[model samples]
Each structure stands twice: as C-alpha cells, then as structure tokens.
Target: MKNEELRIKKSGFWLLASGFWLLASGFWLLASGFYILASGFWLLASGFWLLPPTFILHYPLLIIHC
Candidate 1:
C-alpha cells in the first residue's frame, strides 16, 4: 500500500513536469514562429528546435480553439 502511494505520487509529479514542459515548448515555438516570420536566423533556429513538440501540442488545440 505504501509502495502504491509512492508510485502515485511519482506519477503525479511526472505529469506536472510534462505539462510544464509542453507549455514551455509551446511558448518557445510561438516565439520562434514570430522570429522566423520576421527573418531572424537565431530565432528561426530556436523555433526549429521548438517546432516538433509545439506541433504536437498545437494540432489538437487548433481544432478545438478554432
């Protein structure tokens, strides 16, 4: 029972961390997209690095938000 509780706690922590990372990535991607549009190479590079996770997170929201 104690082990089960520990596992649950760990799982919750991971979930929270994952959510934070996803949000951070989304912000980074948004910033990157703006930079790329403005033709800033460093921003474009940063955006490219951020793109995959942003794309993953953004797709679902696009359908829902729009």
Candidate 2:
C-alpha cells in the first residue's frame, strides 16, 4: 500500500513539473514574439526615414540623363 502511494506522489510531482515547464515556455514564446513585432515596426519607421534622401538623389540623376 505504501508503494502504491509513493507511485501516485511521484506521478503527481512529474505532472506539476511538466505543467510549469509548459507555462514557462509559453510565456517565453509570447515575449519573443512581441519583441519581433516591435523590431519590425522599428524597421518600417527607419525605412520611411530613408526614403526622402533616396528620392532626392535619384530623380535629378534620371532627369539629367534624359
């Protein structure tokens, strides 16, 4: 009877550990996903900032060539 109780306790401990691991991993994934999304927005903003210099440099060159 004691052995049976010991097995039940062991299984319960493993179940709790696995549950905690899954929760931790899920939170980590969510945090990384948010970080990636934020970086993507930053990249888009940087691209916008870069556009005017490109237009200024190219348009006159095209007109001069033509």
Q: What is the TM-score of each candidate against the true structure?
A: 0.57, 0.75
lDDT of 1 by residue, 7-63 (tens): 999999999999999999999999989977877877777877887987867878999
Which candidate leads the pack in lDDT?
A: 2
Task: Quickly count the clashes in candidate 2.
Answer: 0
Off by over 4 Å in 2: 53-66
Model 1, global lDDT: 0.90
| Sequence-dependent TM-score of model 1 | 0.57
- On a 0 to 1 TM-score scale, where does candidate 2 land against the true structure? 0.75
Question: Which stretches of candidate 1 lie above 4 Å from their native place?
Answer: 40-66
What local distance difference test score does each model get?
Answer: 0.90, 0.94
Quote the positional error of residue 34 for candidate 2 in Å. Answer: 0.2
Instruction: Residues 1-66, candidate 2: write the lDDT tens digits.
Output: 999999999999999999999999999999999999999999988987878887867978999999
Which candidate gets the maximum TM-score versus the true structure? 2
Q: Cα RMSD (Å) per model?
A: 17.2, 5.8
